[model samples]
Target: MQDYLKPTEIIDWQHPQVLSLARDLAGDRADSTAIAKICFEWVRDEIRHSCDYRLNPVTCRASDVLEFRTGYCFAKSHLLAALLRANGIPAGFCYQRLSINDDGAPYSLHGFNAVYLPEWGWYRVDARGNKLGVNAKFVPPEECLAYQPRLPGECDFPEIFPEPLAVVIEALQAHQTWDGLLKNLPDRVSVLNS
Candidate 1:
């Protein structure tokens, strides 16, 4: 995907934080899959998920997830992607439409990331709101397509992030690549780091 291959606007591949952490992660030594696993676990436990829209962008980088961080799922995924990309791993953002009931309606939708694992193709990970696997209203790890979003600001569910998920999803459906997904994202994705 040329989109994924192009440099990113949000992730600072040159920051000392990025360089130091990537170096420490065992470049070229550890298998890319293992490194991807390590990065996934780091994101899983590190960032606190929230829908806050303003925070320092520099710190908002995924590296901050380890230092001091809070963000919704997309923000969290950005950080995870940055961390992996640091160590020369190719990572991409994934989106899905999930139908939910309870936020004053019969249904709604949300998005999360599916990181590209060279050996694993793409592995889904949700790093926001709460851990899954219990009391999930519907089947999770859902395909990005095949569902619907209810309304704007329907922030009733404890999900990985908040809306405008339609922007990214539509882009993915069209471009079938990372840059495609990013084309629809805000100039700067928001975050909360308190």
Candidate 2:
């Protein structure tokens, strides 16, 4: 919990701009859940998904995401975590392996978040922004992830991380363009059969 709230190189919740935005979004909200929801929606809608918009330059740092107004799932998750932590809510990264197009082949790692609410313990949310077929919500007790594993071998990784995975950060830093980053995005180390 302390690790989740503390500022990190990637999460960087303590950045002046990130702190300011968090204060603005969660303004006067007494409830942690309410504050978390406010922060989550702002990141989901305000920041455009880089891959979705085909934007270039992979933004990894939370401040960079705020400045560019765009990032991939991993970068977006960093921003969301920063916002929540800035508001004093514990937030962490979560990942899932999804088969593109929901098909049973060609999988890639997808990023989201897990927030620890005092009342609810911990809940997951995807701030990747909504699309025609994908809708992620801030509801608790029930996760409204953008995509669920439909294939027998696809599954969500339940580890709630204090910061972005090093492998993910390295992958983002290795590419200058979104297309390159998307093309060689990280994959799960192993798949679970369910």
Candidate 3:
């Protein structure tokens, strides 16, 4: 629990700006659930998805995402994790391998978060901005992830990690530009076989 809340090199919840924004978002919200909801909504709605908006020069750090108010799914997850942790909720990373097309081929890693609510244990939520058909809400004990596995190879990686996976960070950092990052994004992540 402490590990999830602690600021890391990437999460950086302790950064002054992050802390300030977290406080602002959770304002007048007493319950942990409400705080989590507020933070989740703020991230999901306020932060524009980089690829969706076609913003360039990929950003991986949580603070950078907040400062820019734009990021890819992975970067957005980092920001959500940081915000939740900054507000005293335990938050960790989760992923899914989803097919880019309907055929269930060309799968790639998609990022989201699992937050531990005092009453509900760990709950997964996708703060990826909502569009016409996508709506991710913070409902404990009921999962509403951003994407559902529809094809044969598509699946969720259920592990709740204290920090972003190194492979994800490497992939984001490897590509300097958004188009390049999106183009070369890992089609597969080397998760341990269950």
Q: In model 3, which runs have C-alpha deviations exceeding 4 angstroms? A: none
How do the predictions measure up, each by TM-score? Answer: 0.55, 0.95, 0.95
Quote model 3's TM-score.
Answer: 0.95
Which candidate has the top score in lDDT? 2
Q: What is the lDDT of residue 132 in candidate 2?
A: 95
- Global fold similarity of model 2 (TM-score): 0.95
Q: Write the per-residue lDDT of candidate 2 for residues 108-191, one digit (tens) a residue.
A: 789999999999999999999999999999988789998887786577888888878777889988999998987788875553
- Write out the backbone clash pairs for model 2: none
lDDT of each residue in 69-187, candidate 1, tens digit only: 65545656666667766776666664433323325433223444455556566555544434443211111234222223445433322223222243433432344333333333332
Q: Global CA lDDT of candidate 2, please? A: 0.88
Q: Give the lowest summed-lDDT range of ten residues in model 3.
A: 185-194
Clash pairs (backbone) in predicted model 3: none
Model 1 clashing residue pairs (backbone): 62-79
Residue 48, candidate 2: alpha-carbon lDDT: 94
